[model samples]
Target: MSSARENNPPAKTGAARKARPLKTRTYGLFRWLHVYISMFSLLIVLFFSVTGITLNHPDWVFGNVETRQEYSGTLPEGWKTGNQVNWLKVVEHVRATHNVKGSVADDGYQSDEQQASVAFHGPGYAADVFIEMGTGKYTVNVDAQGAVAVMNDLHKGRDTSPLWKWVIDLSAGFLTLVSLTGLGLLIFLKKIRPAGLITAAAGGVLVLLLMRLAS
Candidate 1:
């Protein structure tokens, strides 16, 4: 062993021996993943960001939207099949007749003593139709959601249908992994040790506090 040590000179030093190759590799992989995904999703990120800013400050600078929609539907065989009306058919008919270029927005169901209503808000406008399942009196309300409505409206796209939306959820999950790996890397690097821990802890506490407050 001594002869071998003398001949090879023990390549790894004390500091090198303590180093974590697995951690470094994981960090590097996650960093690359984060970069590529961020690049691919840059437009989406910017879209959300712009909408967020506009949503936050509505009064200062706001834009107007003009909505014109004509809808007519002959009742399908089971119009109220499965206790839910065929809202999609109505939306599709509107789109085909009106020549809407963008996606359809599906807000939650609106129900009251007189009518059960379904609402859809899309780019530049919105449409809500109350169809009496029993009597078949159709009423449509189409309007715009200024800036705040636009952000809220974006959440309603048919894009939520799990085909492309899966990419979004997947990216979000990987972003969490990327963040964790970055934290690990920061901890592994001794120079920036306490700062990383303090920032992470403070961020976590702030997020928890905000969630609690929101709830």
Candidate 2:
């Protein structure tokens, strides 16, 4: 008679054998994404990081913090017909005369108290116009808040255009993807994953504790 051990061979684990390759593919995908996304976001990451430091310290004066100029000019005759001021022409004249820029502020166009005020605001620039009702003459104050201020303003999205705001949102999305992929890649690193996860957890806790203490 054949030996009992020889009569029944061990059962083959075909499904389990297939699972190993699938797990490897998953790990490879994460690694690929992490590497490419990090390269792609490198510039954006650096920009935000450097600007973050400058933003945290508002008192750090760099470049001309502000430059003020006063301009006085007479509007064209067509701008004012008695008390009914042709506000459109008035605004245009100021812009054309002084090379003023930026979109008009929300409350920038107001006609009250026998005078009209028109204002424009940009990332780090401002222009305010005051026109006397009787005469078509006007005075404007322009303020330039320099390059550093402009960078800070861009970081905060104070008065950027719709396109630039979209850029900010897209950059944020890319950063999130890079971070998630990095963490995913770490999970696949069986040799270092346990220590890596513990370090990450501890770092997060430290940040939370710092925030609480700061507040």
Candidate 3:
């Protein structure tokens, strides 16, 4: 029996067989997630990366270029007789006439003996309306920023809409998924596992050091 067992080839072990398939599945899943998620977040990553550099040095590219304009117009006659300060009518008229772009700020309206003022704020944009309560006359002053400034504002989520804020959140989630899946893929490669983990650890250390230095 001993001689027969020695002569015959060793039988394949059940555990080893199962382990191979499991490992393959894990590697496949990790690779699939890593590749697609990286691709999906590519544009989001690039946008944030470039914008990060631009944000760090605001004056480098756009040089704070802003266009200022003034416009004058007459309001509806009914607005004065019934209610001199019809907020909705005032905002709509200014937006339509001058093609204004912005959300009305909370402190947008103020009343005084002379005139009432309304302020609108948005990413790289601001528009203010001055109305004479006695007469239906109004003036609009708009300050529009350059492209670089607009991009920077978008990156910061400053004066952006709620929808855009949701987009930023989803982008952050996608990027996190991509990073975690990439790290997951390294676990299956036995040959380079140690080196890869060491490199990752070094990266973490480097970031910490940089932050320390910055502080």
Q: Which ten residues in a row have the lowest lDDT in candidate 2?
A: 14-23
Window of ten residues with lowest summed lDDT in model 3? 77-86
Candidate 2 wrong stretches, greater than 4 Å: 1-20, 80-85
Measured by TM-score, the strongest candidate is 2
Which digits, one per residue and each the tens of the lDDT, describe model 1 over residues 77-128?
A: 5445655666667556545654443444444565544566766644456566
Off by over 4 Å in 1: 1-24, 58-61, 64-96, 100-124, 128-141, 144-148, 155-164, 213-215
User: How much RMSD separates candidate 1 from the native structure?
Assistant: 7.7
- TM-score against truth, every candidate: 0.53, 0.84, 0.83
Q: What is candidate 3's CA lDDT for residue 47?
A: 97
Question: What would the TM-score be for candidate 2 when compared with the true structure?
Answer: 0.84
How would you encode candidate 2's per-residue C-alpha lDDT over 122-185 as one tens digit per residue? 8998889988876767899999998888988888788779887887887898899988998998
lDDT at residue 113 of model 2 (Cα atoms)? 51
Candidate that beats the other on TM-score, 2 or 3, i.e. the better one: 2
